[model samples]
Target: MRLRALLTTAALLAASACGATPDAPAKTTLTWWDHYDSGAADQAVTALIARYQGAHPDVEVKRTAIPPAEFRAKLDQAAASGAFPDVVAVDSPDLPRLVAQNAVADLTDRFQGWAVGEALLEPVRESARHGGRFYGVPLRSETLALVYDREVLAGAAPPRTWDDLRATAKALTRDGRAGLCFAGLPEEDLTSTFLAFLWQAGGDLDTVDDEAGVEALAFVDELVNVDRSVPAAALGWDNAQVAREFAAGRCAMMVNGPRVVQVLNQAGMNWSVTALPSGAGGSASPLGGETWVIGKGSRHADAAWELLKSLAENRDNITEFGAGLGALPNRGDTVQDLAWQWDPNVAAFAAQMPEARPRNGYGTKYPQVSEAVWTMVQQVLKGDREPEEAAAEARAKIEPLLRER
Candidate 1:
């Protein structure tokens, strides 16, 4: 079946709940589900919803936050049951899966004249587009950076070059603290961290069988094995654990983004942020963030589009949303102000924005392909597979998926 048809079927399965009632109010209530559970995220989303509601008093928005761990499963269950939300917030990488399953709306009609069209970052917009149709609205975005505790670094600053990073991490890996804390688990986060290195090494994950690929994989293994800068627990650590370890000062530095900065700040930890260490080619980081998508089955398509437009098109709304969530605005103009530049933490992350890369070619199967790469890395980290073997294994697993896309 075509993607749209698949989505229609999923939508029907999920919508069986409301049971037809002619007496229902003429104004539709759109349900929006997201994985943002923090106070800041909630407040940001709430403000956006309120703004949207004000513009169209007839439309009611029911927003709910699902735990990230269970989000995918719940979404799947909703799809199977034909009772999905009217709109959903999805990470760029996972958007493709929904698109493939035909669970999202074709947003091409909604893009024209939307102020968000002018403001959205290109890479973010591209991620939400598939087969010539746009599926989502770019919301808040984030990119990876090196986060370190000022007290641990003392007078010395965080490293700039890849070599400098390695040496600094080695030097800082004393006592119970690790020099680097990265997610090495069997998940997409681990793949994201690895991809930063691969790109830095002038390699591409799509071409994982090359020399740069081997070197990229080896470089991480070196940190885990020879350099001993990473903790053994990293093998089991997911993205959240890496951030937690850094916030607790168990790691001197970590590969993370602004969200981690917000977490550390909330915990009363003293820390600073810097661009990710540069490789031979210089600094690089992956673009990460959420996108707003209308469900393929949404009965109130035009109303959903209006909500999406209000959320992403209004500059003031975007600013308020980004500010509350500690997220950088998707538009360059909004983030180029002197205020953001002067803030050391925000400055470091902003510095890497110029070199930030979207997930390469397999935009849709990003999550699945990423997991395959992580599986390969995990084997190498555990000494169960050599770097070359791991790269080969990753390529073997990813090739078929890429073909499907």
Candidate 2:
């Protein structure tokens, strides 16, 4: 309650800064916010906004790019104060919390009229909806893939099944180099990467304590504790660090998202990517990306939606931004553009899009569930707890969280 009071006060001050007076301009100005703070992604956003303003002279968009680390906390504060910007780019996993709070506008009817709305990939489309209604527009997407060093693998074909992966990793583990590396810390990446393995073992978060889940966790145990193929230090590495380890030749392969392509290219390493190996349940990967949403409090909801359409509907514009963002285009029509299809660095990740599973089904309380899942992963990997015991305890903590939402 006290935090809410402070946020309300802050909102009032911010509102005063934008208040209209006799001398103020009559043109409509939509305030926009996003977390694309650097590199091509930021450049892409700035250019897109400028293009929109150029075409719509009467409407102006004011953009604010927040640092990725602080973006969510700042958004929560804005929601609490009912002072959200007119338009915002939100991470896919974080959308449910805002929807549950009634902080975003319903876009189902608006989406129905959109010419290319049906062209979005199913997982990407599903990630932007809540309660079977649209609340956001997916802008970009990506999923995990296995990247291996060609020379390190010694001309061997990439692993295809669980036994193949284990033997391949063990063989590649020698000369002070680990065979495989993946993000294992207690963060969003950890949960997203682990979900792929869990699903491959025929276990969803809802059945996380089942036999399939135990089998998945036990495989991870064998890799880290028994075979010693994956290093114990993985418990502290995030996605970037894992990429760094791979680039430095300390590891031979890694399970990571598309962004690591840039890091590998800069390092000038010989690499290729493939879909993650299958388990008992078959192949699966997690969907991840950003969505464009309108604030429920926006006075210019119509104009905000129009801007989002302009960003998404045009074939050229969608392709341009998708390339700059280093991810797959959301639209099925544009996803197979010549460059994306031919580029080895991204082709495998692109192929996984149709089957990628979104986390939206976990409900609004997913963040809490994510924490529990990653903690269980860390404990098991560290040999601090047995796989069955850790998974059972984590399942106990997550069941009520999903029910509460």
Candidate 3:
């Protein structure tokens, strides 16, 4: 019996030494999840993953594309199950919540020495960092801009300054068409648009009681009150409504992102885009878009990091991804690259990236804070409260949310 056991042990040791333990099950397949289900974006990511797999034949990548609306819920369930993807793509605004939950991995060391690190725009970079540690890598970015009907504007130039925009919007309000449209519903879209105006007015959500905050609220109030260019229904509009209204030519101009331009063009509307109007302080727009992150529970973290680094730093990949998907590139150098700069519409959006501001005090509880502000805005627009009263009420609500964060 001892002789037989010794022989069996020797056989097992030899099998391990010879790398014959079923070849380690051919290396665990890496899973990548993204909230990009649109046609071009899906194709581009498929192609990029194919290229990555081709380069690393030893590693297999499994891709799952989720629609933006269902992404958070799906991710939450996956995380709870310990089956979260090795790599995740999340919007900048949503990243804070993920970070707060300790769901994402710290990527400071992973991104070190990467070309994408140097190429990232400051605003986009700041959005990916939490507590001085980089938590995500910006893959694409965008900012709100004025999308105007070229035929409607006619000889009139797009507004370059805030004062100019107010005047232009007022002028364009004739003929049963609104001068401007915005998403002002109780949602992140409305909060984002409002923040742009606030930032342009030199205000921030964190400092809602300051002069800039008051001015921003007053400015929005003017659009409804003194100017009367924006329709009262705008208070209930979301992103889709704003786009639909603009596409139908019900609004001569609207504050929207790059996707709006794409939608308008697809619908055969004659439109042009310009930078968000500069306010008393300067030009500013709220930064929007997703970042690539590694989940804390990932088993193939090293492989995922490599994939993220490749996707973010490779100029060809960046250009291909952004161009195919109509996403704005996050890299400043990529924005200036001849390939990206050649597209006039893209160039216009890129110009605004420098002034793009991420949400103030971006952390957990952002949604709660956003909801409170939106409610206040809605009340003010509905004539239930004055701007000062609304601002104070919003401040009161947001202060508690911030403390919870």
Candidate 4:
């Protein structure tokens, strides 16, 4: 028996010496979820993952592209089950609600004094925080602008002021084409587009009952009712529909974002973008975009943070993602890339970034306030309520929501 035991020990030692060893540590697999379903965006994300994996062969990133409409519900379910993804891309405005649910990790200390974080655009940087702490990083951002067909303008300059807008729109309103188009559906579409006008008029969600608010609403009333420059059928149009109408030559000008550039280019139309006509308050645009967050329950938080940090810090990665999606990069440095500077369509949106304001300061009650604003907009656009009455009603509902926040 002693001889057999000696032989066994010798065999084990020999095997170890010959390179036989315990299995290597399992490769770190980080799961990522995002709601970018378009082909260009999907391709960009896939390429980003490929590059990341190439640099870190020991790490694997598993990505799932969720549909936008179903993404929120899926996140809620994952949060409840404690099976959250390692990294998630959420709409910037929804960050407050996720923070309230403790669904995302707090990166305040991790991002403290980080150079990349310090370089984010003001509104983008602000949107990534909740209660004065950072919870995410702004990946890309977009804002509204007035897109007009150059051919339709017929040597006329784009509108620069409210009076110019009315006159230009009226002049362009002949034939079957509407002079101006905007999404006015009784949904977030209307709220997002109308907020630009509201802000331009020196009003906001909290000041809807003020004179500025009435001025904004009444201006739209004039366009739709008095000037007949904007058709009533616009009430049912969404941003995509507005873009489609413009592409089809049914609209001379439209209020839209950079994403419409792809549509216009694909349609082979001659288009140019300009800042929205300035009102009493000057030009103001609403900020919109996605933020990258680490899930609260992620077991691989460190790895996730590394990936997130890389994404924000790497210029190529950031610019590629932004340009691929036709959105503006949130990083001030990246925004100066030749890709954006050379492209007039994107440059127009980038120029507006300085004055862009996020619809996020209202905290978790923002959705409720948006609901009230949209309701008021629908009422005014339908001519069911005068601008003054709609403003009063909206203010009453919005004030309570803001107070609750």
- Top lDDT prediction, candidate number: 2
The lDDT, on a scale of 0 to 1, for candidate 4 is 0.86
Q: Using TM-score as the measure, name the better of candidate 1 and candidate 2.
A: 2
lDDT of 2 by residue, 228-321 (tens): 8889888889998999999999899899988787788889999999999999999999998888899999999999988888887655565346
For each candidate, what TM-score against the reference? 0.86, 0.90, 0.87, 0.92
Residue range with the least summed lDDT across 10 consecutive positions in model 3: 335-344
lDDT of 4 by residue, 155-181 (tens): 789999989988999989977899999
Model 3: per-residue lDDT, tens digit, 361-404?
45677877888878877777777887788888889888877775
- Give the alpha-carbon lDDT of every model: 0.80, 0.87, 0.81, 0.86
lDDT of 1 by residue, 52-126 (tens): 888888999999999888998887787777777899988777777777777888888778766657566676667
Candidates 3 and 4 compared by lDDT, better number: 4
User: After superposition, which runs of candidate 4 have C-alpha atoms over 4 Å from their true positions?
Assistant: 1-22
lDDT score for residue 275 of model 1: 82
Tell me how far candidate 1 lies from the true structure as C-alpha RMSD in angstroms: 10.7
Note each model's CA RMSD in angstroms: 10.7, 10.2, 5.0, 2.7
| Arranged by lDDT, best first | 2, 4, 3, 1
Q: Which of the two, 2 or 3, has more lDDT?
A: 2
- Model 3: residues >4 Å from true position, as ranges? 1-27, 80-82
